[model samples]
Target: MPSQSLAYAVLFGHVAFIVVGALMTVLSQNLVRALVGLIMTLFGVAGLFFLMSAPFIGLMQILIYVGAVSILIFFAIMLTQSWSSGDEAQGPSRKRAVLASLTALAPALFLGLTIIFKSPPSLLVAEETEVSALGRFLLEPYILPFELISLLLTVAMAGAVILGFERRKQR
Candidate 1:
């Protein structure tokens, strides 16, 4: 009933929403449902970042994940034909999905136990340092990577055009 408890409750809700949304996205067979779950997860993560005092990161999360990444994915999905040949290729493979779920769980469980047992030093206090640190790294140590990504994007665009426009030789 107290203010602190209310804050904790809200934070827990965000965390729960994020976890559920992420799992739904991963598990869903339908593309549109997965996209919806991904969007929910993105917004939930943005809320978490905001609570962690990185408002800039929250904004970037929304812009990069929801605005750009999702749109790019949606465009690719749109370009594909919706025809399902007999049994749909888009349907989930139960065995592969189970195997993948188990594989992911192993690492997650291990990392969780390690953190619990090792008891890493807690900051107990975190402030908004993400933007400055991210900016410095982007302009400094990661400048080459940034330039390489740009070059890669250019190459990919050219490749897409070549694939899209190429005509097969007629016999």
Candidate 2:
């Protein structure tokens, strides 16, 4: 087992990456940059899964999220029209910014307070889940939902392509 301090350090690093990545994803004006941030966030989550002793979930996170979704987002960004550079003057007004921040922070604050106030759940022995078991579950029972999600992504991509061409035709 790793030292306690080392474990804490890993936790801190994962949390920091998640926070920074989430901020970049929400705050960046550039679509490509946001996609990069999303990839970073996904990687951080994968690390968290690994830390929690769920290697199968961690690998799936990297494979499905960072690999497939991020690549698809990057391709979509590349295929879409480019936007002007982000400028301070072009940003949202202070009032709107404040409102948006509050909108995002409120639920987070509530959740944080709830967690802090609530009694900790009873500890249970962790069960080991194998990747093969998970694969069978996904393929057998959840196959329809899984395939639907893929179909949804495909439709979204097609819509994006149509919109991109429409913009070109308008110009």
Instruction: Please give each candidate's TM-score.
Output: 0.75, 0.72
Tell me the spans in candidate 1 whose CA falls farther than 4 Å from its real position.
1-3, 82-93, 130-137, 140-142, 152-163, 166-171
The 0-to-1 C-alpha lDDT of every candidate, in the order given, reads 0.82, 0.82
**Candidate No. with top TM-score:** 1
Per-residue lDDT for 161 in model 1? 93
lDDT of 1 by residue, 49-113 (tens): 88878899899999999999999887766667332332334676789878988999998999999
TM-score, predicted candidate 2 vs. hidden true structure: 0.72
Residue range 5-68, candidate 2, lDDT tens digits: 7888898999999999999887877767777788889999999988887888899999999889
What is residue 109's positional error in candidate 1, in angstroms? 2.7
Candidate 1, residue 39: lDDT: 93
